[model samples]
Target: MNIKTEFSDKTLTAIIEGDIDHHTAKGIRETIDLAVEEKNPSALTLDFGNVQFMDSSGIGLIMGRYRLMKLLNGNLELVNLPEHINRLISLSGLFSLDIIKNKGCEQIETRE
Candidate 1:
């Protein structure tokens, strides 16, 4: 997978592309972690809009980031999730903490 990062305010946006599988999840995790450590943002946005395919590894990757953000007292949000991917996240019970959105518009309301 390819990761593109952008920052606005204190939020770091990681735009992930390509298939996220076991072969790629580690690099993604490490890259994002490093970015977070360097940027020290208050929030992190994982843009999955360009991700073509995902498996269980994707869930693990996201959960890892969620835990990392928790330790930092920050937040993690998901943007531009496809229907199937959204369903996967919902089924995995990850939507409870992560905000899943479409076209930069968030459908899931988060209260914190």
Candidate 2:
């Protein structure tokens, strides 16, 4: 998986590509958490526009990040979620998922 992170105005944006399955979730989470520590952003946005596949691991990734952001007194947001990924998260009964300002977009355009 590829996770490219950008920080600006105290917000961190992670553009994730590739499948977010058991094999890649840990690496992706580590990379994002490392960036979170380094940037200490007030908000972190996970962009999943390029993700072609995902599993329960993806939900775990989001949940873990949510906890991390809470511990840091920051906020976590999700965007550009593919339809399947959106459905997965919704079915997981993660109420916070719907609160994300940018959630439910079948796909969001990216500069790249």
Highest lDDT among the candidates is held by which one?
1
List model 1 lDDT by residue over 5-90, tens digit each: 88889999999999999999988888899999999999999999889899999999999998898899998888888766776887
Q: Candidate 2: where is the Cα deviation over 4 Å?
A: 97-99, 107-112
The whole-model lDDT of each prediction reads 0.86, 0.85
TM values, all candidates = 0.87, 0.87
Candidate 2's displacement at residue 95, Å, is 3.5
lDDT of 1 at 59: 96
**Model 2 clashing-pair count:** 0
Q: What is the lDDT of residue 69 in candidate 1?
A: 89
Residue 41 CA displacement from its true place in model 2, Å: 0.6
